[model samples]
Target: MGAWGISTFDNDDAADWLADLSDHQSLALVRETIAAALDADDYLEAPEASTALAACELIAAAIGRPSAAARKQETLTRWIAHRKPSPDTALIADALRAIDRVLGPESELRELWEETEDYAAWQADVVQLRSRLSH
Candidate 1:
């Protein structure tokens, strides 16, 4: 049992892949994970939310968001809405909060959110960002 319905083996493979990624590659992975987590078809859940939050924290650190780690840690500690009426709501809420707190107004994420509330459109930007992973 793993995030996004992926198997334990898949999780291990992803972890291994991440370990070999550069900063930009890591960012791309995070962006992809976030987009996937939010996909309505995928049905976002607690594990996805947790992974997205961790990705946010990682990107925040890479981009120099000093308060990100603390906020994420605190939020995770208090997060107990795992198997409730609906985990998606809580998960999405946490992910959004983490994004807001982790990334400043000047961040690409903040800008994208401001530009369009559409996940698909934002994911397009994420795809574009992924192209820069090799640079």
Candidate 2:
């Protein structure tokens, strides 16, 4: 069993698989984990929350390298632009707030204001980046 009882792989296999991922896959998985954390709810257990943060941080660490892939770059770009819904889901809201706190109020936070009209184009660019990386 895994966090939130969402087991998909044996711990050993999962660890090996995670270790073996390409830079792009690793980065994508990290972003995805952060997204998952944002989606968790009030009844979340400490273990569940810890797992999400752990996974999220792992991914974030991978992308810390200058050579991290374009897909990872683009994912971070688009995810930043997406506004948290009013009555925003707690997990996502907390995750976003936490990231913003880490990265600071500028760029990730401020860019939201500058990128409004260009967000669609930016998102399209992200999809293209992902496609390129997957090839």
Best prediction by lDDT:
1
Instruction: State every prediction's TM-score relative to the real structure.
Output: 0.33, 0.29
lDDT of 1 by residue, 29-76 (tens): 555666655562423343444455455433433333323222344222
Model 2 residue runs over 4 Å out of place are 1-26, 63-135
State the TM-score for model 1: 0.33
RMSD of each: 16.0, 16.0
Q: lDDT tens digits, residues 48-74, model 2?
A: 333343343333332331123313333
lDDT of 2 at 92: 33
Q: Candidate 1 local accuracy as lDDT?
A: 0.37
Q: Model 2 clash pairs?
A: 38-91, 38-92
